[model samples]
Target: MIRVKDIITRINSSSISRRMGQGLVWSFTGTALAKFLTLLVGIICAHILQKEAYGEFSMVRSTINMFIVLGSAGLGVTSTKYIAEYREKQADKIPAVYAATNYFGLLMAIITAILILLGAPFIANNILHHPSIVLPVRVGAVLLFFSIINGVQNGALMGFENFKAIAINTLLGSVLESVLTIFGAYYFGVNGAILGFGMGFILIFVTNHLSINKNFSAIHIKKLSIKKLHLKDFSILYTYSLPAALSALLITPSFWLIRSILVRAEGFQELAVFEAADQWKVIILFVPTAFSQIVLPILSSLHKEKTSFVSTLKYNMLIVGVTALLLSVGVMLFGGFIMRLYGATYDNSVPVQILAISTIFSALANVLEMAVYSLGKMWQCFAINIVWALLMVGCSYYLCMRGEGANGLSMAVLISYVVSFLMFLVYTIIVVRKEVK
Candidate 1:
């Protein structure tokens, strides 16, 4: 058996550890600035829009976001992996990879926008049951096209480790979004709020696109390999993105379903409270997310050569587990203040507490899910997530029917994550050990 002392002594020499530190420094800086900006926007918007209207506004934005992920087509992710892998070894291939990813993502996003535009009536009137926002939903389709393409750029930048450009883009985008949201809400009420939301995403796309071109000037139209690109290469890219897009297609509706269930059970007022607290969930998650971004490309590049990923996993568990605990405590103590940002109606704290508690398990799951992705096990993670999402819908529905309130829904989400974390842990162990064999 490996001895404890030897394991402890060798920790300092791990390459992943060193690289993690480097990636974390950059990622943390960007994530911090970006999340802070998002938080400020949410707070101000909540303050400006009244309770029910604020709820409606959040619903429109969240629903739009849910669909936006579908456009990623996994190529957004594959770009980062392929770019990182080939950056030094196959430098000429960079332009081909970039062009393929960008063009493919943009194409898919445009199609997605069309679909959203066509379905906005059904979604707003039927699924959302909030026909008042139908116009906003239609307007949001344009934003969807832009946002999905932006994901492609951001993913490519992540591959190049040009986090400074990514950070600046995010900071600028968030500030613009906040200003517009506040101004629109102040003037035109709910419709203005919706305008700000959609326009903000458009600004994000423009800034990110410009930033990527500025940072990676090698990929101009003249330098790209579009003329030489073959059908087989596009087919290969399609294969990479199919599973991701499929997952997004399923997952986005699942999220929409949960909010739908919650609103149906507890009303839009409670949904407002739930959304308000979720911002903090986003805040706490920024830490693990920063690490995951760094780890994905690293793991993708090194998966074949092999090393002990378990050590790094342990280090993350400690860091994220403890951080989650602290965050839960912080929310429990001061959650009221957070909800109060929305107004007196949101000041209820049970949902906030439940949501905060869930982040611990969710954070751990986020790391493992990404690790699984790194190992090329995308389908398993997706299957597992689909089940978890269903559980969120089913469990939340069953419990809320019993009069457990929004807390019932929140608890269901928390339980689903715990189950997911356990499943991922076991499956990952089996996969890793077998790989060694």
Candidate 2:
């Protein structure tokens, strides 16, 4: 018979649980503080900028993020998955792997950045339908390049489980970005705000580079050899990263399209309200997002241990699902007060409450998605994301057309995620059964 004390001792002695505890502590601390600063910056910007300008700022940022998928090309998860799986087994090949990822990431970044630069005016005029904001979109192009490289670097660190370094860097980067963005918005309005965001990404890229260098030395990877990268070195990119990248291609553009539909159907005022409520969604998810990040590397390491992997995945879903429910309830209870932070223009509570409820489904889907990633089933993941993205875009476009405004868009999110959670649930159960057998 097992006693409570024995259970406690066993948990404490478990290597995976101990590492997870340490990672969560640092991840929560840094992510919470960083997201708080981000929220603060948004509030200040909303108060200072006109509603239309704030809307434009939000739109430009979204467009940049859409393009960012091209540059990132799923390399972030690719790096994390491979590095975590291979570090102990193939320590000597770590440098080659790192070098190969960087080379491909850099090439993609250059191509995507140039594409954005050349196409900004067309995007502003044709897609966004606000040609006056062309320069801001151009500025976002620069941000895209640095942001992609930063994702790769951060992914490498996560693979190594260097949560302490990630936490410190995240804190410092958030502080710098908050100061610069606020200053820029104060002086030059929309364009300056976008420029400030670009500068922040540059700083993050440099700091991450420094951290990765030190991590390499600590892990006894003496050198990263770009010169020796061969065809085999790039197999991960084709096998895993391509499907992951294609999945992002479907999802990110769908979001940009959804926002575009809302903006065109209802205009910037409605978009501002949507963006305002969306900030809270970001805040509530940030904690769970941290948990997901920690779960990925740990799960990747346990991929060969089917029973432990299934147990870990179940535990993660329970924790994240419960936490999401509590946070959603809290947000609903304080909906009006939270919306008021963005000032009177965003005082509507319906959208906030609607998005709050959506968080529960999003949380569950995230855990299942992580399991797919850990098992290296990128094609299956992409297939699921296709359904997810299509539902989101279709529902949002239809609702926005029906004149429900921001509230409609929020409802679309809730609906899409509900279906997605069920789909992921069925798929994950099948996968787990097979693995356990």
Candidate 3:
């Protein structure tokens, strides 16, 4: 019924709306593509290697990630927060922040590497129940250096709002990792897969270093003076980031503990099933994880503007809730098909699928948690995350002992999110309400 001119106007308005609506979509798509490539590499490794071999690889990777968290010392996040704040006022200070963060991150990485190398034998024999993992765990320790460097560079790039570079670097690293992993597994077997992962981290480190150097060439390394680094700046950055870092340290190990329990109680086959389900869960998180990255800089900028923090929080919740809901539905519908991609052994049962799909809530909770971090409510975020991690351990132990098997493990994860989400909701409401008044 509308005239052609009116229709054109309406079309233009809709086009604008679509672009706004697709903000999360675009970010998620880029991340999903990168993860898909990485997952394809995983798939090839799974097929080429035996179940025990894949299980061993997974165990070593988890161990490496745990230590890497400590090595990072939360500097990446602290850098992002401080860099975002300082970039507008004293743009010159940005390089100093970068330099200080890199120095600290490297120092922490060395400490963590020493501890990991010393404890590798204990961890392999006791925690993983696989003595063969000792060598690979040591090999993965080398990644800590590269990871620390990459973290600093990524934080700086994110602060600068260089999403295109961030996305490209991630994609290229993932693709290269995939290719190298396939080749490594083909020629070198399980140890080769571990080597390939280390190589991937190295590639990312190099790419990010070059990219950051090219963009900030004029900033000059001579301008970065640790002697000029003020305690006040470090305190502020630590106050804002310490909670999130502690929370990550506390929470990530819970998964490894859960796996340890399963391996000790049930056996490697059960661990294999759990690993397969966990992989899919990680894949589904690719989109939400990417969206969180985009959201962080925006929310940080809004906080700096002294905008209504509650409004920003609500907007983030609304967007994340909707996106999470749609993605959850899709995952639930197609999860079994996706699991079948791993192999017939991993097709799993109905209950396991249902429990795994429940992780959508967990992913949504993560997005909300990030929003809180953006608002500088890291202490509260830390409290909630720790509580969730504890609940996960308790529930997983009880369910596994009660004979729930992989389903119990999945249910434990789901319960942790439910409790954590409720607690976060209460905390957010109380805090935001007080701010409103």
Candidate 4:
């Protein structure tokens, strides 16, 4: 065993190790609080709403989430990368970058709104096969504007390493959403749940907007004029961002396709099982989501310095792997009990239980994906995501057609995640090796 003095000396040698440990603690606390509140809200919704309604809600939310990626246009990520680089150079271009990108975000939001309005009916009727979803889908479309702006502001904050602000925004949004959703759903049912989600974003957007304005008073509206925007600068942003945007669109929307297939082939009950399992998986994902939020900006800064990418990758992998292992064990052990919190009916399905357990692999993959993104390997990430999405869609279709029910779908999910994780691992190894050499 190592002596206490030796351990203390080792820890003192690396400032990064110390900072990372602190970041992890803060991140874990914020994530846990946010996820807990969200999970509680989900539990309330699951108990109050019928499984069919819950499944429908999940489908609609997933569809709207897909559009969020478009509204974001990967600018948030690109902003973080560039802002971190600029800060290191101690350049005064920060205000200009912010001004330009905010305008870009607005433009993207406008275009997204138009696309949503034009395609709302078709998406609801044909794609989701639920014309009833049209109204909520349209309402959620308004959120695209809010989401885009929020992304930009949050990206900038992350670049400055303002984790406290980020944490506040996240926690506040989640808490407000949870309280509003629970009370709303209790009174007005499923539509209330949807409304609460919309309202939550609106509140977050307003709060963040105010905070940003106060913090970055130098970045005035006049500074954000389109006339001052440089096409060359915009091109640089797009060059870095397009892959991330494409990857998000390809990967995220595929969930809806799987949901649609399940609805058509297995009916609402099986869909409900799938959604239940997926909810638990989302809870497990909060760990990685929080980690990514903190890691990306740090990695972006380090990358600009031409640091040891291999060591960074190894460190990230170790932390993520250990976290994933603990979460997996916890989730697997408590999955049945967790399901019971949703409702007695949710605990009936063994396959759903198994699916929730499989989230371990998915969570690990998500963490590794974040590592890849940090290295600015968005093209590789995009390619791998597309391949995985295609495979998931195919597997989902085949399983649904075969009438294996929710269990079959779960198996497909497990296989898809395993494949994606392995692919990400191989790609990460190659990229890290190249960077080191």
Q: Per-residue lDDT of 1-437 in model 2, one digit per residue for the tens?
A: 42545444544566877887888899988868988988998889887788999999999988888888768899988889888888888878777767778888999999999998999889999998999899999889978889888888888999989888788788888888888888899999999888876676787788888988898888788655677777888998989889999998988888788899999999999999999998999888887777888888888888888756766776677678889999999999999998888887677899989999999999889888988888888999889889889888989989999999999999999998899889889988888777643
Best by TM-score: 2
- Quote the positional error of residue 122 for candidate 1 in Å: 1.4
Error of 3 at 124 (Å): 0.3
lDDT of 3 by residue, 3-37 (tens): 44443344245332243245455455555677888
* Model 2 segments more than 4 A misplaced: 1-13
Better of 1 and 4 by lDDT: 1
lDDT of each: 0.75, 0.86, 0.71, 0.71
- What is the C-alpha local distance difference test score of candidate 4? 0.71
Q: 1 or 3, which is superior by TM-score?
A: 1
Worst 10 residues of 3 by lDDT: 11-20
Error of 4 at 111 (Å): 2.4
> Ten residues in a row with the worst lDDT in model 1?
2-11
As for candidate 2, its clashing pairs are none
Better of 2 and 3 by TM-score: 2
Off by over 4 Å in 4: 1-12, 213-224, 304-308, 348-353
Residue pairs with colliding backbones in model 1 are none
lDDT of model 1, residue 138? 81
List where candidate 1 sits over 4 angstroms from the true fold: 1-18, 214-225
